[model samples]
Target: MNMSPKSFLFLFLFLFSLAFTYGQEGLPRLRISENQRFMITEDCEPFFWMADTAWELFHRCDREEAAFYLKKRAEQGFNVVQAVALAEIDGLQSPNPYGETPLIGLDPRQPNPAYFSHVDKVVEMAAAEGIYIALLPTWGDKVFTHSWGKGPEVFTEENARSFGKWIGNRYKDQSNIIWVIGGDRNPREGTSDVAIWRALAAGIVEGTGGQDKALMTFHPQPAGPGGSSNWFHNDEWLDFNMHQTGHCANQPTYQKISYDYNLQPVKPTLDGEPLYEDHPNCFNAKELGYSLPEDIRRIMYWNVFAGAFGQTYGCHDVWQMYTTDREGINGPLRPWKVALDLPMANQMKHLKNLMLSRPFLTRIPAPEMIPANQEDNTDFVIATRDSEGSYAMVYFPTGQSKAVNCKPLNSRLLKVTWYDPRTGNQIDAGIISKAPSNTFVPPSSGGKGHDWVLILDAV
Candidate 1:
């Protein structure tokens, strides 16, 4: 078929639009929506926070390596990259690839500009790819030394505030920077350590001059597959709640998300660190076996449909930037560079796409819409619906059939469709007469381990 001149022009413009959508450089500053349940751009465009965990991005990867990782994640539909400023593994003692430590004489107030310049480059690199950097100022060990991490406890209250202010000022003008204060550490109640983290957050506010230009949240240590809401949910500076589902398979992620979702002061929440793809179960590589891409698929859908504003995906090797030169922390099987193409990293875009395809602002978790038992087992189905009750999504992690309470959907005739989380495709399940209870059996996928998403739209 020959194209007319008008058709050719339209094709050209369409291609350009696609390029602009993906290739646009700078990001609009993100803010919580008016309802306080989700995030939006400054212009109120719905922002689904699909992030990749790269905790060691600045501390381990060089400039070129950082660029490569950022570009790939952008193509994979990730909008955020979580990284550390003062890394976890010997971050204070070890120099970066450029041979510079973050502080002078292990002093938080005396920041080395040379070392920070490298972090500046990584931030800029991420921004150029239209990605936000969830910047952790320092790993948890610096203040609250637990059993495992490298720690000398360098932070005093005065220096914590100073360092927070200094780092906050350094990237104040950057549109893509989000401050992540706690690096997987929960400060015990009535401890000076709590004061340290609060001071750092206060200094960040002071440094930013309380402009609210940068979004901030805390990354709590998994209280054994627990949430940040357990510690800092009520804290004023915490913009959103983040939960670390940890490396355990079959975590009851919905419990954590639901607990935060219904809190007195409503805030957006997400699984910041779910089971990293390919991570050994419970950090045990030998007996328990590594989690696959489907494990991530299960966590992503369960948490998001249960009322999370966003979700972060991780790979064991990529988080640590593990390579032959360094020890394989937690038994990383591949180098960080090689692990970048893991299937789940690419699959995360599908979840973002599915969420964006529906109503953005008015969506809510509607567990009452599904009749599945909310037990600790892997077969638990999760459900969500539009506030208007026009549409609903149910996630089946192990491909099991479940009875749904269609009356909660408020539709006489319900059009059901099956959405494949793995492939990002929708399969029609035909309209059915709506009753109080509707038994919907998904297509058989042998028995277990296959997952499917059930979408119901009121006709």
Candidate 2:
């Protein structure tokens, strides 16, 4: 029988839709190099750091909620998510809030296969969005115990290895997974805990088919750098260094921590967990309230400029919240849910693009490059340059007006532009004088202020 014209058109449209959907499903694999660098097949070098802090995974929530959060993260230009396997609040044995799906019993020493299956789905979904997963096995689970999960007793070398093997085998082939070992805290006895972590690292290496190992790091307690300084800092198993800045909102102190990490000899370092939304500032409790967008930007740019390869952004309530329902388990999702849409996310994207645009064979921060005028203030400045002198980027953030001077490559002929980081807009041509000094005036606005990016190119 001959098909009518209308019928033929409908059939063609349906086939076309399927092809489009299939094309969208394709995603890149994320893997780590021997040097501990995060390697992606796509040219994501000068890697733009787009990350979010969804620290809770394997919580009371279902796989569906995890997928929703991961998908939402990708939509907002977040290519990386920092999450824990045995969620701090919920563990493998935690009750399933959804009565429809009953919890299965599994040895707590080994990862619950059911929970990891959920993790696999989340990782797969993130991969489809070009997002990578920074998977942490347990959140201080090895050292501490609370309502979340059994710990201390679970912090044995054998158990760590078994847990690592289970996880590594599950996603061995998936390149988008980054293995993060430590949580927000460290082990009690330094040597034994290090041994346990090493065993786990070995398990991951073996399970991931070895050689092509996953990028690995330890997440230390607040105000600490992954317990690496004494324990795993230079260990062959560690790929990079990660630090938590605690919940302090003081911009100056937070930025300094980044500067110090930049000086480490290892591959690269980053602030894995910084101050979260609604967290009280340690320095001043009543003076500075929580969830200020400017405070977030200050910490982010400071970390990036100070030689950190990436930064993680998070909200307090969201980081701690887990749910079985669509409406989110925490408080009404008004201000907290909307926090992701804030200016900080867009600003980081713009900076990532700028960094990737330049050819950076080597980047060295020039502390001496900062001018005397800029040195006396609380504002933090970090400068880095490519080897050939073709490109350079400087980030300067000060609560008050400050003049900055830097050594310029061909100062007279360099093309300089000041970037308003808030909107990612560039100001018209500004020149660096032959004397190699430029004056930058911080916005007159008090405490909550703006940062500036100075891009210089040899004309």
- Leading candidate by TM-score: 1
lDDT of 1: 0.87
The list of candidate 2 runs beyond 4 A from truth reads 1-44, 57-64, 96-106, 146-153, 224-229, 251-265, 283-288, 322-336, 373-377, 399-405, 442-447
CA lDDT of each candidate? 0.87, 0.62
Structural RMSD, model 2:
4.3
Model 1 lDDT tens row, 1-459: 999999999999999998877654567889999999999999989999999999989988899999999999999999999999999989998999999999999999899999999999889888888899999999999997789889768987899999999998888888898889889888887788778888999999888778476588989877733477776778888889888878888778888888888896889999898899879999887888998777678888989998999899999999998988888887888888888888888789989999998897999998787765567777878888899988889888887778889886767999989998877988998989988888878765543458898999988
- Model 2, residue 292: C-alpha shift (Å): 1.8
Candidate 2 C-alpha lDDT tens digits along 277-311 = 55555534466555566677777776766666667
Best prediction by lDDT: 1
